[model samples]
Each structure stands twice: as C-alpha cells, then as structure tokens.
Target chain A: MANTFLDRTALNDLLNGACFLGGGGGGPMSGARPLIDLIVKEYDGVTLVPYDSLDPELPCAVVAGIGAPDAATHGPSFSSAPKDAFLKLQAVSGTTLGAVLPGETGAMNSIIAALVAAQLGLPLVDVDSSGRALPTLSLAAYNLATEPTVLTLANQPVTDEQQATAVIETRTAPQADSVVRALLTTQAFEQEGAFSTWLMTAGQLPGASVDGTVTRAIAVGAALREARAAGDDPVEAVNAVLDGQLVRLSCGTLTAFSSHEGGGFDGYTIVLTDDDGHVVTVSAVNENLLAWRSDSDAPLAAAPDTLAWLAEDGTPLSNTDLRGLTAGTRLHLLGIPAAPILRTPLLAARFAKELAGIGFFGQAPRLD
Target chain B: MANTFLDRTALNDLLNGACFLGGGGGGPMSGARPLIDLIVKEYDGVTLVPYDSLDPELPCAVVAGIGAPDAATHGPSFSSAPKDAFLKLQAVSGTTLGAVLPGETGAMNSIIAALVAAQLGLPLVDVDSSGRALPTLSLAAYNLATEPTVLTLANQPVTDEQQATAVIETRTAPQADSVVRALLTTQAFEQEGAFSTWLMTAGQLPGASVDGTVTRAIAVGAALREARAAGDDPVEAVNAVLDGQLVRLSCGTLTAFSSHEGGGFDGYTIVLTDDDGHVVTVSAVNENLLAWRSDSDAPLAAAPDTLAWLAEDGTPLSNTDLRGLTAGTRLHLLGIPAAPILRTPLLAARFAKELAGIGFFGQAPRLD
Candidate 1:
C-alpha cells in the first residue's frame, strides 16, 4: 500500500529494478517514463496493489506483447502479437486474471506490467515467471505448471494473427524451442524478427510462478540510489545487496558484443589480460555463461551461475554494448553466477557447447 | 494453372521465389513445405489457384504467427493464440475468411498463406502490400488508402475453439504498436530477445500493403532460376528481372569499412569504384540503411529504398543470416527501390522525420 498509495517514487524505482532484472534487456526509465508520466498526469498516482496482497480471485489478465527489440524500438506502432494470445489462454483455461502479470523482472517487463495494469485498471503484480532472462516459454520455471504454448498472439497496428499449427503444440520444450527458432530464422534473415520469446510454460502461471521479483528489484534500486547519494560506490552497494562482490578489472575494450548473434544470447565473452601476470577472461554471451579467473586452473563463474559485467572504471557496459573495444582499454569483469538463468531450458552443458570454438583454459563448470 | 500445378521441384522453385520475396525474413521451409505437401499428398496437386483467380466475394484472412520464431517453429502443435484471434476477428468483422491471405512477401508469410489456404480450403492470393521487404505492417502499402487505426489482432492455435478478447480492436495503429512494443520489451528482457524482431504493421495488413510480396518474390526467383539453369550469373539475371543492377558489395565480409560507431553495430562504409571512375560509398551499421554515390552529392538509395549487400566476391546473401559478413573483405552493394510500403497513420512524415537519422532515402514510392 505504501509503495503505491504512500508514494509515487515506487514507479521510478520499480522501472530501474526492472531494467537490472532484465538481464541486459527490458525497459526502464526510458520506456516506462512515458507510461508512468501519463498515469501520474491522469490518475495522479494510481495506487498499485502489490502482488503479494492482491486478491487472486479477481478476473484480471496477464497482458504481455512478445517480439523483437528492434521491432519494438524501431516500429512501436505494431501492437505486439502476443497480447491476443494471453487473452485466448485466459478464455480457454477458464482462468481470468484480476491483475496483469509481469512477464519477467526486467525494467521493460515491470513497466509494461505497470502500463498494462494501469490501462486495464487491474492492479499490477510484481511477480514474474522467470526471475532472470530466458530463451523461450518452456524455460519458465513454472513450465511444469502451465501450458507450453501461449493461447494467442496478435498485432493491432500490423493487423495480423497466427495460430500455431499441430506441429508446434505437441512438441517438447526443446522441440518447441526449435519451432520458435525457425520463426526467428525468418526474422533473422530479414533482421526484423519479432515474437514472444518467453513462454508461460506448462505449469507456474497461477501460483508458484508469481514472485515479487519486481519489488525486490525496486528495493535494490532504491538502496543503490541512496548509496549513490551518500557518495558510496553504487556498484558496491548493488553488489552487497545482490550478495555479490565488487571487483575492478580492465580487460581491454570490448571487441565484440552480440545481442542478436544467437539464441538467448548464448552468452558473450570478453578477451583481456589483467595486471600481475594474469590472463583473466569473462564470458556472458547468454546469462553469464562462465568466467575464468587469473589462474587458468580455476574457474571464476560457470554456467548456471549469474554474472553481470559493469565498467569498474566507471564506464557503464549494459548488455555488452561493446562496439568499439580496443586493446589496453580498461574494463571491469563482474563475475556472477548463472543459476538464475540456468533454471530455464538452457542447461550448463548447452552453454559449454556454445563456447566450444573459443576454447577455455579450464573445464566448464556444471550447474547446481 | 501451369504455375499452380507444381511438382516437388516446382514447389521448391516457388518457395525459393517466396524466400526472395520474403526479403530475408521468413520461417523454415519445413513448416511451409508440409502444408503444401500435405495438400499435394492428399489431393495430388488439386487444381492450384493463383491470386488473380480467387473469388472476389470470398472472404480472406492474412495470417502469420506473432511469437518467438524458435517457439512457433516447433514440430507442430496448435495452440490457442493465433487461432483465437483469427476466429475472434472473423466474428467481430462479421467477415469470414474466403481464402488465406499472406501479409508480406517473406517465405514464411507465403508458406503461412499456403498452409492456411490448404487447411481452410481457400485460395492463396498472389499480391502483397510491399513488393520488397519491410519490418512492420505499418509499412504495407494497404494503409495508403485509409489510415485505419482500429486493428483486430489475434492468435489461434490449431486445436482451440475458445475465442474472446484474443482479438484486440485498437483505434489507432500507434496505440496498438505501443502496446505491442511494450510487450516485446518484456519478452526481449525475458528470453527471445534476438528472435522477437519481426512483426506485422497496419500498412502491411490492410490495403495493397505488400499483400502478396511472397508471390511476386517467387516470380522474380523463377526468373533467376531460369537464368541459372541457362548458366547465366544469378546476379545479372536477378538485376535484369527487378529492373535493377547489382553493384558489388559483400555482407559476409564487411570490407575496409568504418562509417560510424554510435548507438551500436560495427558501422562501416563500402567503397565501390565504378568502371567510369565513379565511386559510390555505402554506409551501414546493420542492413544497408543508406546508399549514395560517394563521388557526387546526390543521394543513393535512401531509406525507403532497400539495399541488399552481397557476401565476399559475389556470394548471394540471405537476409536471415548474420554470419554473411566477416572481417577485412571486398564487397558489392545492390540498390533496389523499396517495394511500395504504404504510409499509415503511424508512418507518415511525422514518423519519417523521427527516423530521418537512418536516412530512409526514397520518397513514399507509389505503385501503378
């Protein structure tokens, strides 16, 4: 109640948190600002009920539009093709949402939740199915709990609709992944693919899937703000709160960072040598696949472990925006575990496979 | 009738044409093939109907799935998403589909049209809104007639009968685009960030909008096939067919090109010195966004003008593959006027102004 009614500040905090949990994706102040501003202007800070306290019986819908970031960024006029799918699922399952559900914990997902909730007049739930980034719907931890395939997908501005054929529905999760991959292949060819990347899974939609990840993100963001205001290293504060460490490493400028290169990012790698006769390396192609420490014998972080790389030298490196990485450029390598993402369909073994050509000094670590 | 009476080999040619028409963004041939194959398998190539021969009074629906390509590309399972939206739209408009309509020229779009036509017992139209490739439905030429804002987006799976709000009726294309963009932001932050790039648009769906880009592409492709069978260079043959010429450019190897390093992407410039000592320098960060004769001040193929880059030497580039480019390479640049993409409420001068930085070169080209 306080977060929504007591203060309007929560929206900003939530959006920032959403961005972090976005795992290099999702919207934040940039995307959420417009919607939030509109809400404040029109409704004067509509009190959003927290997911924990919201009534489950209320007939609300989890509204989400899934597609490519380029489509959303370059072509914002096309209504995402997935919202219609959500509605159909609601109708078919006889489940009516009293509130809109956040698809993930990222800033974009959280703010979208806020926007959808505000638009539909449903209280927003801070809960998201995947606490971290994933590749498809089957990766939803709640997949054991919900339908593997979404009910419907539609684009309002585009005026198009699709119904998955018999081939897509009956397939297994990985098989489904291939189907989605095929669809993406077309988009990839055109460099304009867009569709629902995250899925509701087979289980998880109703109960177990709903976690207040957004709330957690907001709180962390608020604390970071306070820490920054206090002249404290915001990174350190974030590290402490997230139960991680704050380390500074300059591993040359990023030579190449890819978002559209592979499935679920498949993780990325940064090549650099550290001081003190150490050749340190970090890879976060998809969800921080792994990290190699100074000594080749030891693994810093591995698949199933979550790792985030920030510019320890104070240069921000969100989602591998490494366009002009050069030799001798200072960069920080934040090694976090990959467990957060390992929860999805992508396994540590797969991560190992993706980085095979790159050849690591040590054996790839297994998942928890 | 001859074209419709396609054998396996002929169908492959058609698919190739469709792929070219798809403008590098289309789904796997497997999904599309089976649908046509199923028709052929069951009916032994029942009288194939061309778009011109379709019954004018017959109701039709342009269809394609709007979700992560990987997920939708699954083996084959019908879900509720697109079908729900399709049925809902059919009911809302009080118009039933007389035939299957393809929204764009992409290979998948054509296949989707064929699949729906085969399954629904409708004829597949040969016309498309765009004669070339575009990212959104708003770019379709159909919107040139009336900028319809209210769009009914839906998703229907093969088996589901339940349909309701799965169809979204929006009053404005931008509004729908906004909602869909937000939804995609959620999905990208969650998983399918890379794949969720392609989408539909108002201009794409409604009017003469690349209504049958696929069919036309197939036609062009057929010409190329003829040229190839006759041992002519595919490039020269295609150039002649499109009323265009193939300048040298390679996507696989970016060449000695560095145009700009802002936003993202390895921005670079391709320098081509014509035999006349006339130099044309093309710059691009991703796809060829701008092309101009560098020696002179005149603009080359601008924004609305679509350009396809070739790989090293003369390898034809598939728009879907990103690996088409490598380091330190020679290339060719082919300039083609953007197929007619009808202007929509969301994509008029105002929107074009916003996108001016990309240098969309062509004026809103009109078709005969």
Candidate 2:
C-alpha cells in the first residue's frame, strides 16, 4: 500500500488491524483514531503507507507521538516540540522524505505517526518498531539485532506557543530508543512521557523503516467500516479484516479508577464479581497500557494484548471516556497489538527502571 | 578573573565572591566548602574560569552537580542526576572535553560545577549562565533569542540505573526547563537526583558567549582555602576575596522540607522567628530558589544579596552536603532574595515562565 488515505469510515477496521498487528504492544485503538482524525482534518492532503511498501530509495521518515492518553483525549493539542523536532531534522540533515512510524507500536503509536505524516506531507509507513504493541521505548525490533537501523532522531515539543523547542540528531538503531524515550520525558515535563523517532533501513533495502504501514492501517479500517455498514457486528468486521477473533466482552464500569498521576495515566479493574466472582480487569498507562486475559478465571499476561470496556455496539470506552462505568454497563473485549512489544526487553526495562524509580510501577512485571 | 583553580583552599572565598557578586541572589555557603573539597579531592585537576574569557573554539559544558544546597541537607542527593545527566550527554553525543559550570550561582551551583568539572575531567567555568542566579532555564543568556545557533543543549537523567531509564534531547533553551524538570521529578521519585549538561556553544562565537569561567571558580575556592588555613573566618576570607561583608544571620530550624522532585534537589525551609513573633521564611526549589529576608520583625523588600548559609565553624554546607541539618537542627540564615520568588517578576520569570508554564503571566505577578 503506497498511499492509504483513510476516510472517517475506515477507522474501525484500521484500528482492529493495528491492534492484533500490534502483536500485543501497540497503543489502544481509541487513542490513535481521534487524534489521527484531528490531524487529517487539520491537513486534508496527508497520506499513510504500510511500512514495507515505500520506495526503497525515496526519502521517508519515521514519525510517532505519545502523551497522556487522557490529555490526548482531552487536551490532545500537542506541544510544538515534535513538529520542531521533525523540522529540525530537515534543518540539520537534507533528508527530503522517508517512511516513518512510531519508534514502537503501542496504543498511541499509530496516531502519533499519523499526526506527523499528515503534518509533514510524507507518507506514514505501516511497519512498526515492534511487530506489536509495547510498554516501553527500548522494545522495538528496530533496536534489536534483527533489523536495527535508525535514520534520524529529533525532539520537538511546544511547552508554550512561542516557547517551542526541537533537536535533530543522527543515531544508531539500538540507541534510537535512548534518544526517543529521553526526548519524551524532556518535551512533556512529566508529560515528556511520550516520544517519537524516524529510521531508515541499511543494506540491500535502504529506505525509511516501517515503509507501508499507514496504507495497511487504512485498508484494515476501510474493511471494518464496510463490515459495520453491511450490518455485520463491528467485532466480526474487525476479525474478518484482521484475521482476528473478536473476544466476547461483557460491559461494566471501572469499579475503581485512579489517574496514577506523576508520570503516566493508569487506571484499574472492572469487576464482575456480581457473577459469582466473574472478574475482569481494564487497565491503561497513557494509552491503555495493558489488559489481562482471563480463561475461566485464570490469568494471562498483560500489555501486549488488552481488554477494553465498551458499549455493546462496539464503542471502546475508558476511565476518561465513561465517567461512570456501572457494574453491568455493556462492555466489549478487543485484543490488539500489531507489534510484539510486550515480549521485548523494552517493557521490562522501563518498568524496572523509570516507573520503579518514580515508585509508580504498581504491579509485578510480566515476562512471558 | 581569568581562571580560578578552586582547590580545597579556595572554596570559601569563591562562595563569598559569588554571594557578594550575586548582589542578592547567590547561594548559601554551608555546603559549598565540602562540595568543593569533594570535587577537588575526587578529580584533583579541577579549575574554574570566568565565563567571559572562554575561547569560542573550546568545547565546554554547564553542569549542576554536588547536592543542591537545600536538597543535600534534606536527606536526599541531587548530585547523582546532574553528574549522571552530563555523562549520558557525552555518551550520546560522542563529545569529550570542554568546560563545565554551575547552571546558576546559588549554593550548589558553583560547588556542583567543581564536582562535575573534576569528575568529568573538564574545567569549571566561573561564568554561570546568569551573572547572578535566576531560577529558570530562560534566565540563562543562551536562550530562544539565539535559536538556530550551534549551542546544542541536551539533558539525561537516571530514575533507575537498573533499568537504565533516562531522557536526552536537544531543544531551544526555553523548553529545556521542562525537560530537565521532568527528569528531576523522576529523580525525586528515585530519592537521589543529580544531572549535568554540557551546554555545547561551539558555533555561537563561543568565546563571546562564555567567559573564562572555569578559572574564576577555582580562584574563588583557592582564596577561601588560604583564608581558612590562616585562621581567618571563612566568611571574612570569602568576603575579603570577593569584596563583600557579613550581614545579620537569622537562626532557626527546618519547619518543612520537600524534594525538588524536578531533579533540582529535595527542598526544605528553616523557620527563623525573631524575638517579636516574626518569621523569616526560606524556600528552595533547587539550591535555595529564593530567600525571604526579615526587617525588624517584618519581611524586607528584595534586600538580601545572595543568601549564603554556613555552619557556626564557618564550614560551607549545601543541601547535598548531608550533615548538620534536621527537622529541628539549628541553622544560620545568610539573607538573600529576601522576597518570595513570586514577588520579583524578573526572578519569577525564571521559575514561572520557563520552568512552569508562561500561561501564568498577566496576573500581575510580583514579589510579595
């Protein structure tokens, strides 16, 4: 897919595709859609491509943005740094264009890429740093020995209107992460919690990393929208488009919720103890960081794959989205992680390092 | 003036010089002596020069090391992050050698300068970003007004060395405040925060922008050390070297203390109530962010020059010094800033606009 211009209709399928494709590590679907829509609306001429399809020689850049998913939903307006970060790359280096994607695939990763893509007039690639969603910055395939190569690293954040800041630097792939995560903390000020990076492949295929991802996302989105319109349940539409199964979900409210202040936005479980202790949990760190899988009350690993509370009609809802999620509120369970980030060391490293340092890592880390 | 090789003997004199030269906003002397000694002993090749004489062609850095005065004495360590921050910058940027200095001219500013300079094998630059000390990143001369210049700015912090999580990025000087502050918060969480930065000013007529600051810091330290050996009061020795005097000293114990979680250091205050039921309050964001001087049982206007606290024995102690300060331990106040940080717009701009957000202006902010 060269240029996938996703209209409003294709959002669902694209989200579903990105989710499972997130390989249990991409950002939640809810985060990427609204923000991406806002970006697309802000600039009507943007194009998104799957990471693998961008011309091997055409200039392209990897683009991704992250923030408190709550702020993203509420004050989603980004600080000017990332834009400055991107433009500075051009200022320092003469790279005209290249494929781009979030440094890793997480709940908010795609939208950040979409936002940058729409703004920079470059096609966003569908390939993700991780094959699926991840919890931390270092967990990208790009950073691993498999296909490690990063093209450009930049810092763009707008602390205030005229107080925008940016930096562009060249980096090695493994180190791309240190640059990305550091930039996130720097730009956000506690909010620097999110970061972005751009990369190009080395050797026989020399171009931006994650070449054809955007188009793939749109294709998935379009298929879901079509399925929904055809009267098929949105979950079915998602499964068919993504070759995934729409796990049955029971709607419920966040019996407990906390903003998990300091650094990221973290929330708690949806207990269906009403059904003789039928327990379910819904969690998030910025953009739905995780969800535990339950098989007859048995526990599964978290992060890479997630469960969500939504309207029976297939509308995803979170703590911020549904102020009062009642015990029996209609809910839907959707699993998405286009890139396999949960399986990477990135998640382990962040939880062990930062969150622990801040004393915010609440649960035991998963190593499955 | 040209170079100040602040060996152990020079600590007191430099502190007095910075305090006197600070005109009203320098820092305390308590922690400065030991910190200077700590740096000199550790590295043995430390030198401080005035900011004006630095050759533009020379590579240099600016760091905030040692314990932030208030933070050091508050049972936490600030030297960790500032010192660690710069090393990461060097690693990521692959730059070696240059100059280093206190980010400002407060208690830990110059002292940290020595600590980092010696530790990093760099000279301490006496020319601080601010002629005196100002509390915000914007207070430095190298700011937004000088964008697109070669003054590359980067920051790194370690919340958990285990995970080795930190943030690093280059940005306009304005946004650096937020970035660094966030890194500080991570430090606050970790209980020990210290960081350093090599404010790269290679392309901006580096000589014109920075003076021979490293030598000056060393000179100040040497003079004070000489005085101490001669049995002269460190304060008197410092004053004589810097051309200043000892004003009234307020006596009290810590009433409250909080970590300058923003990576500056942990902050605490000493409440000195004069005989007439009056309170002289001291507050610190990082290294005594501000001081409220007392006048005849009433707070004075911006009356105190730089506040330099000291042990009765004339020993210098900073928040990072970690000795002789407790919830009820006695303290001697060196009057400076004598006004709430919010009182002076000039000073407040550093904390408010640059560190916090600029949206706070327009309420007619002033020193109380």
Give all candidates' CA lDDT scores: 0.46, 0.46
- Candidate 1: regions farther than 4 A off: A1-8, A26-73, A77-85, A91-94, A155-171, A187-207, A243-286, A293-299, A312-317, A320-331, A336-368, B1-368
How do the residues B47-92 of candidate 2 rate in per-residue lDDT, one tens digit apiece?
6555456676665655653223343344333344456666666665
Candidate 1, B-chain TM:
0.65
Q: Interface RMSD values for the candidates, listed in order?
A: 23.1, 22.8
The candidate 1 chain B region of ten consecutive residues with least summed lDDT is B189-198
Per residue, candidate 1 scores C-alpha lDDT tens digits across B1-368 of: 33355445555566666555443344434445555566567644422455556544555555554333323344353222333444555666666656555555544555555555555555555655466444444454545543324344443323344222333445554445444434433422220111111122222344445544544565566776787677766667667766664443322234233333222122345555544545555544333444544233234444445565433333333343323345544444555555434344444553343223332312322222
lDDT for predicted candidate 1 compared with the true structure: 0.46
* Docking quality class, candidate 2: incorrect
Task: Summarize candidate 2's per-residue lDDT along A216-295 as a digit string, tens digits.
Answer: 55555565456556766766665665456444444343344555433333333333322333445444444344343322
